[model samples]
Target: MWAAGNVSDVLAAVPQSAGAGNTAGGAINMDLILEDARRATEAREAASATPFDGTMEAEVSRRVLGTRAHGLEGPA
Candidate 1:
């Protein structure tokens, strides 16, 4: 558990509990990131997709920037 208040109260608290919890959370987050990357790679390969060529990338960027400038872009 996490707590914030008076300094003495905080000092008396068990800091290791938060440390252990955060360590567990970090591990879980890393596993999730790895799994997501694996899935994304699988999807890209299945699509027979290649990385965007420079011209195509530039066109997409132009359109996106134009839309944003015109306030036509949807919520991020």
Candidate 2:
């Protein structure tokens, strides 16, 4: 999972059932997963925007200070 600007991303892999007939019939589709991720991201962004102040200065500062205290880069 990842969050950027006004979007979040999610990628998941579902396995095929072995009892469905074939044991090696599992498949992976990036396009479908990407679309789902985009939708979910948009939904989250919309929800967040409803109450956001349109600025993340405080949050960014807190993260930076915390990182400095820990002697490491800010949380990613």
Candidate 3:
């Protein structure tokens, strides 16, 4: 038991069995961490973007363009 209660000790306490590994195994791998972060961000962005977003943008563009092509129009 460490009286200092260092961060390394706390990290080491975690089991590798979990998805996140502890520093007890070895040095931290920045590449893996960055890759994991990138994957998480991509997944989050994909989940946040609903299917209707694309359709809504396309519909608005079409209406605006259609109105512009017409002789006169106040609202699309």
- Tell me the TM-score of each prediction against the true structure: 0.50, 0.31, 0.27
What is candidate 3's TM-score against the reference? 0.27
lDDT of 2 by residue, 1-76 (tens): 3222212212322332222213222222455678899999889888754434546655665666865544556656
Prediction 3 global C-alpha lDDT: 0.56
Q: Report the C-alpha lDDT of model 3 over 1-76, residue by residue, as the tens digit.
A: 2122244345543353332333323334565688899998888778866647887767877777775544465474
RMSD of each: 10.5, 15.6, 11.5
CA deviation > 4 Å runs, candidate 1: 1-13, 53-76
lDDT of 1 by residue, 28-59 (tens): 78989999999999998787536686876667
Considering every candidate listed, which one attains the maximal TM-score? Answer: 1
Preferred candidate (TM-score higher): 1 or 3: 1
Clashes of each: 0, 0, 0
Candidate 2 to truth, TM: 0.31
Worst 10 residues of 3 by lDDT: 1-10
Error of 3 at 64 (Å): 44
